[model samples]
Target: MAVLGLQVVFSLVMFTFLHKLAPYFSVGRWLLSKRLSRYLHPTNDELKQLSSGNQPGKTTGQTSKAKRRAEQRRNAASAQADKSESFTVPRNLPIQLDQALVEDIDLVPLQFYSEYTWLMDFSLCSLVIYVLTEIYFIITPHRLEFNLSILWCLLAVAFCVRVLASQAWIYLRTQEGGERILLVTFTFFFLVFAMGVLIVGDNVIEFGIEEGYKNFSTSATKFLEQQGMTSHGPVSFLTFKISLAFFGMLVGTLLTFPGLRLAKLHVDTLKYSQDRKITQLLLQINYLLPLLLILLWVKPVGRDLLCGKTFSKVKPVFYEDQFEGFRLLLVVVMCGLRILLMPKFMQAHLNLAHEKIESIKKESGRITNIELQKTIARVFFYLCVVAIQYVAPVLLILFLTFLLKTLGGLSWVSLFGETAVSFFTPTSKPGMKLPKLGGENSTLGTIMDSAAEFTSTLGDIRGIFTPVWYRGILNFFLWWVLTVWFSSTSLGVMYYSQNL
Candidate 1:
């Protein structure tokens, strides 16, 4: 539990720091360009002027003062004309396109091919196999589990088809319009979803069970034993399914921070001409603080505390009571810190966004139909990705909570309490009292116990779907949304004099 807490804290801190550092990183690139300019080749015009012995900054010592002044004025006028035409005269501009830049751009296509194109081919092959196998099963429909297996096969095929279609669309539209950030974001999401389906599909195929559905009792027994925790009741497959959905959603949500940040940076780069160092710094700081806070809260107190056997042992009661208090306190402190920093962060984001919008408006001059369509498409895509990243996990968690209640007779409050305890408690205690089962509880308990035992015996079966690190992104999103909503409402009422 302590390790988990520390991990979470570390991730949050890293994210915060990255966000704050983005602008400075951008500035660093600009600085590097400026410093390297001296090494760049002279432009054609510059070379011509130098070869012709017509240096703008040079004046012969014998030349009359008035003539020199007139020459300077002429040069100034020419420079102004060049500026009006948006022409820049680089003293040491590159004679040829930088090989590194060419490589960077070319690598994007190679990456696209490797990540999406290759995946598409693999999915297509899988779909073909699935279809052929399903048809064979249909022809020999004498089996009891035929229908279930067929459904599972169909689902597998459908997912593969969807993957293929999405990849094709991305490829087709890649040239028409798409930011690097947007493409990368979608690609990552697609890969995550594809990996999940593949994992689940492999499990189903191996078990020869339709959709890999295990009996409730069997699954419950297996899960408890796997956790090395004594089960007083059965576990439900439905409950397990719900948990998996929540887990996926949480993973997706955690992934969104990087995607959103990338999208924002892309948008900003397109929209703003000025540097955004401060804005980036604020974002990085925001990401870093949460992680640091988690680390601070989780790190062992001292050598004495580390050596203490009593402190090292996991106690459920300690997690449920003491850990809860500790978490609550930590949350309060973090929230307070965020609130204090909110004004600065909001200012930076808004200012950068506003500047970008203004720049876009100026650049467009008159928005054409094609430009408008591109803008709308980009907006839609950004919204879709953001919404999926933020809302999916929350919905998944809620769905899991609901399913667990219905199928396992698990109380939502008690389950959360258990989760809290499991997360915080140091591992040492032998046995703890399980939460009481509610409506239709005994039957479910039996099913869960049997399932748990079966799963324990087959270690490979349990390993198929478990995630290494569980990120509670949904929980964070829920809190953030609630905070924003309340804040907005309070501000609205205060300004409108509604309370008065």
Candidate 2:
């Protein structure tokens, strides 16, 4: 009740400001507003002019002279036809692709642009609340009754999942792309992989999920008994692991298309940026960072390598809790790097038009003008959809980590030892009688009394959803997301490499 008033006021003010300002300003729109060169699709006249070996606006005499030169070359080629395989090369055909700048106005009509804007705006709002909450906690000893920031982060994650699922659904609706089958196949594979990981001994993987669940169950059982409710813990061990496996399966399906899209963009980005060694290096690092995060939880390799002697049970370096802190930090860094390089990835995708035009030049057959136009135009048209695929997974992972930090009782500053405090501070000591309000028998007294009751109810709810349970579930989720991301992306990269 002490700090609730200020927190509520701050949240409302920020929410209202964002809600109103969103129309005039948005991070998503701004990101897409960056001007990039786009190739203009060739018109029928242009293709015909190239195919006929004639230049536009040429005088009649110049056209006749050009035709005579072409006829002479064809005669010479025919004279030597018996000596060499016959082929006709179009003369005076130069592919000078005109370029235009793609701006925010161009993206406004693109598919998924609104959804992308909403997602980015919501993510920004969620981040603001989280940062404010953290600052409030740091300065005040009185604890937050219920962290609204957690609610915001949860909403952001849910929204991201919905967007990704919709993207996957688009593939399913097509039915002929094999994408539908791939999604189903990969989901099952991840489910089996999740179960396998869960069954392995903690000595090998070190998730500590089993221990955390045991502690949670015992705590919950005691709390239930004290409240005169009967329970055999919350769920059986087998049931828990099965539920976890299903969750992992969901993550796998959501990430499948994003991973593949990333791989395609990565390969294209490399091709588009052949001369820029630094950009290529960053792309590789961003692609491989997930694997490094996954290895951080592997007991024999990640933890043992850094905190102790390799392949040994010994411990000598920093505290075990610090390892968790470092992992969290790395995820944050990777998310930042991905955001920074988003423009590069997006531009690489946009350059598909140029690439397609170049590839068409290599073919000997004539391409219909409509087909050529669609090839160049669709790349810029689907810009927003591609942006969604790139941004969704990164946002999901970022906010999930924030939820894990808060719910798992971990701290962003765990390395410096400023761990998160308890959720609330009581107005009075335990077992003490409630004091009379400052103004007895008045409206203010009644309001204070109601506030106290509300705070108590919130406290009871927090007790049921304890951090021990959160630690188990969240750790499993974070690990599963990282594992599936690395596996899918690595597979996608290899697939593209071989096929291309």
Candidate 3:
């Protein structure tokens, strides 16, 4: 009961804090305004002069005076034209982040929280139903008490931290693009560390009953045995492998949405002729992809799949076949989509490139072909970096998982020797003597003892080293990233084409 109350309180705190913060973090608005001013609005000086109170016909009104004034006006106009031509326009002009745009940005976070509320409400109701069922069982003399308070606490903490960091990072990026690298770096590190702690500390077991653990462990062991594999202790490797696969699939799916959206926008931009359209598409893709990838793929995938258990001890063959099928389907669909859209994507890139080059040539007729090539190369380099930024972390996680598993056998051997030495001592004096059993008897006895000791001492270590929940985490992350990325990217493309 107390645990239930705590869950409710945590939910309230999270909702309330996010509700208050919803308006302050507005990336979309900042991007929109920046793009608008850069591609549409005239420079500050131009606007200022147009709005200025200075005029030519104030006090003088005679034929001779009028002629002198007209002559003076012609000279002034020529001078102004020269000045305009000489003025150097700023690149990547900063937009004034305002309250109205901030309010517009609030809608997204509010809608997100509103959806979250429905989920929490359903969860709370389900929990009540579960408690009532347990009570009925208890009345019939069945042991029914199950505590999930600690696990709930951990999950709440994880969720809150993830949301808070995400919002903070977004807010910081919009307010000042200067610290984006630092903020994103910090967020990534925080998520990885939190997930590591959650996994290593075994926080997930607190969520359910002891029976749950037994069922899971037994199922895992049987599955492994069926595969002609034997473990000295619990078979956590299968669980971890399944988890990672699921995470990868989920991440892939989640990423697909945004990827598709970006692909579509690139297609549209290719068909369009305006630089504004291209810029808007670029900004939208940049802002949405990072946040979506980080929130949906990075944090959730790691925590849910690596630390949480969603799959019971299932057959490796079942999981492997399912994953392979899903991967094939995903790749096929994505490839098809890419193929269909390839012409548009390429055309958009080329069109934008050509448009930019023309604009530069018009501005400076003396610009050389070599200089243009250098500029194009710089732009392409930045684009590549952006692509890498989103992909590298995911690949790194996959690599680390495999690398650790490959060294698992050596790790076990080293641990075994160290543990045996720590537990036993050699005596040279007195009547102390080691058992002198020979052949199979000695080997069998030693193997059995080693198995027992290792199982007892290294159960948690094995769990930590092997991932058993990655699939779910990865899936959750991927779903989120794809949703956000696709939506935002689409909007950006639309906004640019229409408004620009």
Candidate 4:
């Protein structure tokens, strides 16, 4: 009560002082005029009448009508001014900063940059790549552990230096632009954003790793141990592989949305005509190359850490699963070249894009849709050939899925100079049997036929990857569902692992 009374007394004293000082302070008088004018504003006629000091008999209705018309005119002018303001985001902001970094750079393919700029790019890419490696540790049956090894110390020191380099680069760049105050602010905010994103990823990955460890340590691996079939490699490899595939795709999808958003901004904002291929290639190098390297380097055992059970065992064993985590990671990433790249194909739709998607799109009459399709196909084929290391044929299914999505039902078959089989029904109510390729009794041809039928049902990867046909936000939500499902499974595994 005493504090409340003192507050009221302080407020009264301040109000009295402000009232007395209104005439002396320009700011105070302006504020007072604003507050008082709201209820006292007069129309032109009233102002003229006041100036003339004339009293002409007029109905209250006439004065009210004049006031209404004046208010309407003022409101219309305000709305017109508001409409003229552009919706463009400020340049060099954390969310939009990557645009400025590339806007002024040239697109000469394979050209190198200056030492400091290269150093800056390296540092920025390292932060992103480390985030990816951290993710691999979580879902690949390996929990990150600090080691006393000297190599570990070197790597740790390098990472610390990288962080400092990113800060210095931002500061120096802002300094060059003559925004001295923005140097500290941009560096600080961007660091916070980077750390926040990595931390969220870490928590998600850590939770899954910890839970999976619990699950197999007790019941699943325990059951296999009783049967004397306990090999964490294959024992929990399937679960781990599925989790990695889902998580990798999930991360890839998330990266695509923001990646394309930034790329779209570049397409929209840059004053010069950009070389589409080189621009996109540079983007992939800066934002995506590290993640790709981490995915490719991942092996069930040799490259990655041991399983939770294996790591926690009395003596740890280091052997990888045959075609589990790494292979799936490869496929999940490989199929997403288009998925990770919508802004590259941002159409020339004027309503959706405030600026042209790319001036290059309009520059050439020879850059046909067929050429675009072929370009996509050529890259995908090479990527598959490189990443599909073991049981390399498994990627065939993923590739087939991609084809089905991009090319309509029978159109893909036509590309190979082959015909698609349709309704192979028997004349007399008996169904047609798939014939053997090797021999009458051989199972391989029938298995091939069955696989084809199954793959046909997997639906469209093309429709989802294409910017014109895709719903990016919806695709992201589906990946989120996968995260939730697998995350829950890990928790269940942990719960039972504890009890058993």
| Leading candidate by lDDT | 2
Give candidate 2 misplaced runs (Cα > 4 Å).
Answer: 1-3, 55-94, 309-317, 417-434, 437-458
lDDT of 2 by residue, 1-500 (tens): 45465667667876896789988888888776655656555445555677677654432445576564443233123324433332233322466666555656666767898899999998988888888887776666545456778888999999999999898889878858788888889989988998899999778887778888887788778778867999888889999889888888888888888888888888888887889899889999998899999888788787778777573676646466677788888999999999889888888888888778777777775555555556777787788899999999899889989998888877766554434322332233245466776786799898989988887766765677677778777877888877887788778889989977
Q: What's the C-alpha lDDT at position 348 in model 4? A: 15
| lDDT of residue 272 for candidate 2 | 79
Name the TM-score of candidate 4. Answer: 0.19
lDDT of 4: 0.31
Of 2 and 4, the candidate ahead on TM-score is 2
TM-score of each: 0.26, 0.83, 0.30, 0.19
| lDDT score for candidate 3 against the true structure | 0.36
Total colliding residue pairs, candidate 3: 17
Candidate 2 has what TM-score?
Answer: 0.83
| lDDT, each prediction | 0.35, 0.77, 0.36, 0.31
A best-first ranking of the candidates according to their TM-score comes to 2, 3, 1, 4
TM-score of 1: 0.26
**Candidate 1 minimal-lDDT segment of 10 residues:** 97-106
Better model by TM-score: candidate 1 vs candidate 2: 2
**By summed lDDT, which 10 consecutive residues of candidate 4 come out lowest?**
93-102
Error of model 1, residue 472, in angstroms: 12
